[model samples]
Target: MTMDELLHDPEFIELIKQYIDYLKSSVLEINTKLANGEYHDVMKFGHNIKGSGGGYGFMELTDLGKALEIAANDENKEECQKYLDLIEKFVQDKN
Candidate 1:
C-alpha cells in the first residue's frame, strides 16, 4: 500500500508518524556521532533501521540502512555519506 493509504488508515497512521519521528531523530543522531568520528553509534543506528524498516513496511529503507551499516563498519566515510544521502532522498521522496 502507498504511504497515503497508510496515513489514511487510522490504525497505521500513528505508528507511521512515530516511525517518521524515529527516522528524523536517527538521522540527527547519526550525523552528530559521525561528526565526532564515532562509527559505533552510526553502525548501531543503521542496524536498528535495517531490522526495523521492513517491519514498518519500508524495505527500501531497510536496504539503505543495510548499506549504511556496512559502510560505517568499514569506516568508509564517503560510502557512508552516499548511503546517508540515499536514505535522506528516500525519506524526502516518501514523505
Candidate 2:
C-alpha cells in the first residue's frame, strides 16, 4: 500500500507509532555514540535507519541515514551533528 494509505490504515497505526518511537530513541542513541567517539556504533545506527526508514514510508529519513553513515565513516563530528539535528527535527515534525 502507498504510504498515505498505510499511515491512515487503522491496523497500521500501532506499527507506525512504534516505528516513530524507534526513530526517536535511535536518534538519542546515535547522538550519544557520536559524543563518545564510537564511530562503529554510530555507523551501525545509521545503517539501521537507512534500512528501515523507507519501510515506514519515510524516504527523507533514508537520505539522512546515508549522510549519517558517511559522517560516521569520516568521523566528522560537525556533519554527524548536522544529520542528527535533521533527524530529530524530522521526527518532531512527524509527531
Candidate 3:
C-alpha cells in the first residue's frame, strides 16, 4: 500500500511528517560522519532506519537502509555513499 493509504489518520500523517523531518536532520549527520570516516555511526543509523522503516510503513526506506547497513559493515565508503544517496532521494521524495 502507498504511504498516503497507510497513513489514514491525520495525526499519524503528522507523525510521519515529523519522522521525515527527523530523517532529514539525520542525513546531514550521517553525511558528516561519513566524511570523517566514521563508519560505525553510519552503520548504527542505517540499522535504526532499517528497523523503523517497515514499522512506519516505508519498505523502500527499509531496503535502502539494509543496503547502507551492509555497505557500512563492509567498510565500503563508495558503496555506502551510493546507498546514502538513494536513501536521501527517497526521503526527499517522501517529504
lDDT of 3 by residue, 1-95 (tens): 66777789787788889999999999989999999989999999999999999978999999889999989999999999998888889889996
* Residues 1-95, model 1: lDDT tens digits: 88668758887977877888778767877887887879888898889989999877889999989998998999988888788778777766666
**TM-score (C-alpha) between model 3 and the true structure:** 0.91
Model 2 misplaced stretches (Cα beyond 4 Å): none
Q: Which runs of model 3 end up more than 4 angstroms from their true locations?
A: 1-6
TM-score for each candidate, following the candidate numbering: 0.84, 0.91, 0.91
The CA lDDT of each predicted structure is 0.83, 0.89, 0.91
Clashing residue pairs for model 1: none
Candidate 3 contains a number of clashing pairs equal to 0
Per-residue error (Å), model 3, residue 73: 0.9
Give the better candidate number (1 or 2) by lDDT: 2
Clashing pairs in 2: none
Q: 54, model 1: CA deviation in Å? A: 0.4
